[model samples]
Target: MKSSAITCNNGSFFNVFDEGMSLVCDEDLQALAIAVIQTEMKAVAKLADRIDRQFVQACHLLLDCKGRVVVTGMGKSGHIAGKIAATLASTGTPAFFVHPGEASHGDLGMITRQDVVLALSNSGETEEILTILPIIKRLGVPLIAMTGNAESALAKLASVHIDVAVEQEACPLGLAPTSSTTAALVMGDALAVSLLQSKGFTRDDFALSHPGGSLGKRLLLQVSDIMHRDAEVPMVDDSVLVSKALLEMTGKKMGMTAVVDEGRRVMGIFTDGDLRRMLEKNLDVHATRVATVMTRPCTVIASDILAAEAMQIMEAKKINALLVVDENRHLLGALNMHDLLRAGIV
Candidate 1:
């Protein structure tokens, strides 16, 4: 038993020493990683070379489509197809993913002649997908094929073929759909982005599609939609004592109040910031007038302005709240940065 233990220890020692002394240790693995990435990139780069009449025709068909872009695939291609559909849908191209299996079972009814079908298959032949090729052709809906095998049956049947062929798979066995799927995904992203640029998709347009997301809030939310309005606004006349304004401010819990004139136009703004400066000057809060300590030319914004733009202005001016005013400069509402934060517009 002792001899066996010594042999085992020697074996481990030799193994460690051999690995430490090896000059190419882990270098081959790094090279392989780089090679895989290069292969995927080269595949995508070939798209420019392949951009002939077929690509232009495909773009034209999609541009003229009045209905949704139906994207379908199988296995790993299906996952990529779903993402492509989502990207297209968000980028002005109305699209949805339909499982090829489900399409054969009656979901094909969701497709229309006005719509264009984007099919993904690395081999250009997925049995479930091919099974519906005839039906799609019969429906007279245009087929845009995204595949590696341009000579395959599906490609032959396609109205336009986009070759997303990769040199090889990243998998050592070259059996898993590694590089092929990556090529397909990159091609899909390229298509979506191209369509997006062609459509002149503005931020406002993107916001409309993403109303529940942060991007929508940034573009669609207006200051008037969130600010405290009318009776909810805390304000006082210049003649009012600082104590009176403080009471209004405290009651309203805005940490400040606007000082207005006889015309109901904002004359100045009083806030905790002003209070800090007042305390430093040893001024008596009760004896002071609202105008004495208020900040003049208080940053004001129109109610029609986007909340995100308002946030930018407030941040750039180093202020927290903005007095919302009308065209005639009458105080309409009040908004603090927190208001935007709560509304998810910040």
Candidate 2:
């Protein structure tokens, strides 16, 4: 046993505990926090080492699942189950949590034979979970059990047993679920991300699932969605003077104008930068045809391509404006850096 320090300030005391049965003073609080973190880390480390065929088998089961991954638990385990379900759902797997106690009261209707059941119970002897085990078996749904005690009832009834037994709880009393719950959460994430990879899930898939988020905007937003269209786009015919092209650019405030043919096909692009370079040469903007000053073979993007892809093209080419074109290279619209900026995509 070690001595516990009681720090008295203004006759008030703060009593804190340390790892060796010693007391933590204000000065020792950091060390106590480090111990708590290390204790939980060890649980995760042990889980990492024990990941064997059972973990791999769980991944395979989830990968091949025809429907949702139905996770259920009781008490503290139930909280972990709900979090695991949320993580899996957001990461590419279709999953949700079911309350085991509620299952006995008719919530079992939420599950089906096409789904896989992931039951979490540290002791593997949770009564609510055990009571519904027969019905889960009856429904012919595949059972995956996560428990500390492999020999316990839930494990015995499982089609695949995932033993998440931690050496000890981070809780000093060893009663509250701490290290065990952390280990379980990590294991669920491992399963979710691994299964995501096995399914060849991509950022595009994730973006679709998270459509209301910024990632969705980046991956799903198209050039056509943000481009200035119709008469809003600045354009001029090749026969127009460079000075007239500049008028279109100034009026539209796009810093550039597309030089087109009679059919509105993109012939070239004249930009403010071209004006600066031509000004140095003293070329008469009023006398030169827009085609003579425009940059030929300007970088263009398909209206249907992802806005993110268009941004990449812009950055790679070091150009700010892009002509949105059809398959025939006819100019449909115009997009500039300002457009992407206003759309909050820059």
Candidate 3:
């Protein structure tokens, strides 16, 4: 024993108990996870091909719905159903989530005669969901069941059954709801998006529902609503000196001024950038007329156009400010990029 020599590698662990944890790092384990994902993706793809008359019928039912779509489910199915309901509600269709458990405990009052109940359950026999079925039926509301089992108790009771059955579970044990839940979620999205397209839901309509988001700012903000009117608008007569135009730009804090003729029509625009270019040429600001230094045929737009459209115009013309004018070329207002940003139009 005293003469024995031993050497160990740096990569090998000393604790025997810790070696078992290597299963988490095993390549076979990783391959299994990848296989599960690929299988689920294929399932989703096959489901896409199955969108036949049943899918169209579902869309039609939702399109004709005069009231909100009441979505309900149990367990993991409930989570996916909640997201589907939100997507439908935000995209032209009125909808809300109703937990089946709560529905049995007096939340059933939320459902109306005009409403359609879309129930979700992988097994289609969730006790909580089944308990609310009679109440939904008594309320004279139709049910749309989404489940894997076509012969499920819930499916048998539904007016229209949309099968979201998957070939198998992605879970190795086949206990966890994986592929089945994914199929149901994707199917729900398909329904919501199809209804959204059928309704021809415009960006403005979406904006109205999401005014707190950036898209709402882009679509809802109008030129007249955000432009600087009256004293804030920088303007100078054509005969005014270039120095006076610069002063107007400074005082108005717009970095530009409208050069107007005697008829009150916008003849040209003078900007801080233009003033810098003029100075590089050693041009006499004191003697030169504002009209001589201004950029003619300035970019103009109607005050009623959306601010998002205004941003596009500014980008297209390679300019920062716009002269808001009426049909007669009468200066009505003016605004720059900064104004749009302040109004959350950016």
Best candidate per lDDT, number? 2
Query: Per-residue lDDT for 247-270 in model 3, tens only?
Result: 998899988999898887999899
lDDT of 1 by residue, 227-346 (tens): 998788999998998889989999988888999999999999999999899989999998998798899988888999899999999899988888999888899999998898999876
The local distance difference test score of each candidate is 0.88, 0.89, 0.88
Q: Which candidate is the best by TM-score?
A: 3
Query: For every model shown, what is its TM-score relative to the native structure?
Result: 0.88, 0.85, 0.90
The Cα RMSD in angstroms, rounded to one decimal, for candidate 2 relative to the true structure is 4.4
Superposed by TM-score, candidate 1 places the C-alpha of residue 22 at a distance from the truth, in angstroms, of 18
**Residue range with the least summed lDDT across 10 consecutive positions in model 1:** 1-10
Query: In candidate 3, residue 159 scores what lDDT?
Result: 80
Candidate 2 per-residue C-alpha lDDT over 234-266 given as tens digits, one digit per residue, 9 for 90 to 100: 999999999889899999999999999999999
Q: Which stretches of candidate 3 lie over 4 Å from their true place?
A: 1-22, 26-33
What is the Å distance of residue 212 in model 2 from its true position? 1.3
